[model samples]
Target: MPYALPLPLAPSWWSRLLARVPVRERRPRLRVVAAPHGGGTAPPTLTELYLARRLDMVRLALFLVDDLPTAEDVVQDAFAAVCRAYGTSLDGLQDPGAYLHTAVVNAARSVLRRRRTARAYVPPHPGAGAPVDEGLLLAEEHRDVLDALAELTRRQREVLVLRYWSELTEEQIARTLGLSRGTVKSTASRALDALERKLAKRTETGR
Candidate 1:
């Protein structure tokens, strides 16, 4: 019953993974206000921000958590947290966009943490297979890359996704993940090497 932002259509494999999220009516727009800076462009109202960045945040969450419904929940929780902390107008927050990005990352981590704890007490159940569409095509290479990413440790996946997919700088990734810049750089390097190994092995096995 929660609001589900429709994932945008794209040829990327992640888009395939996200294609079935149900759409919901958007909440009414909040009043927009001038940004703190004089003569600067106004910061987006919470609704505007949701419209513009929801797809990207969902992509980030999908990569982190690897499930469409859970990813949607993570993003919704992120926006709710922002609204709770800064209100709908988002007044007084110097960098609301960055804050929202961090919120998504943190929310995804919380989901993973809670999932881990739940698994200790609950029996694992097979997930319902998402219905596949013949019309929604994904490249084989894209599928391979996603499979490779899944083999990565959570920190490695976070570093690589933030670095390459999100196009965040090392410092930005460090800030979002609460790691030192050096640690981010090293993790990215090691993650890339491990990913390459996995992809290469897959290729050889397929041959």
Candidate 2:
């Protein structure tokens, strides 16, 4: 059940991202974690956290890294880092979910860094092993958006994904990305504008 996600419950921002397409009541095919209830229950163990959030984190990493296999690797490395540092019980961590989120983000950055430094990286050609991941059962419209997203700068994509997909607040995104609140705000603003322009151009060009 490693590929299992709860259901399609997209946030409002996701709809906005697909506004260019005809509104069909479609939701983003990603797992959105519910807010934690207020109580004194013990924090989730590392295994519990992985079982609950692995697919969701994979989707997040997909947005950052732009492919399924690499995204899965990013998530695996993130969890491995968490286990190495905190062990299975996650005893000393107050918010394991947030820590995991930050780990995934950081791991994705490392992947992008390595990709940039590599001398002979070949971009994935169209129609070659792109539509194969069952865990990433994204629609054609969603793929269009992803194509446009790939045009954005890595920082812009990071800010937009964390802000819209992860539903993180400005302060949380700033802390996760190690930028100021002001920087996060400006980055998200610019990212959204840029995404809209890219999507719009896609619509106009009909490509």
State the weakest 10-residue window (summed lDDT) of model 1.
131-140
State candidate 2's TM-score: 0.77
Instruction: Mark the regions of model 1 whose C-alpha exceeds 4 Å error after superposition.
Output: 1-41, 131-141
Assess every candidate by TM-score: 0.75, 0.77
lDDT of each: 0.73, 0.75
Clashes of each: 0, 0
Model 1 residue 104 CA deviation in Å: 0.7
lDDT of 1: 0.73
Best by TM-score: 2
Residue 112 lDDT in model 2? 89
Q: What lDDT tens digits, residue by residue, belong to model 2 across residues 118-186?
A: 735766545455546533345455666888778899888888888766668788888888899999989
Native-to-model Cα distance after best TM-score fit, residue 71 in candidate 1, in Å: 0.6
Model 1: how far is 64 from its true place, Å?
0.6
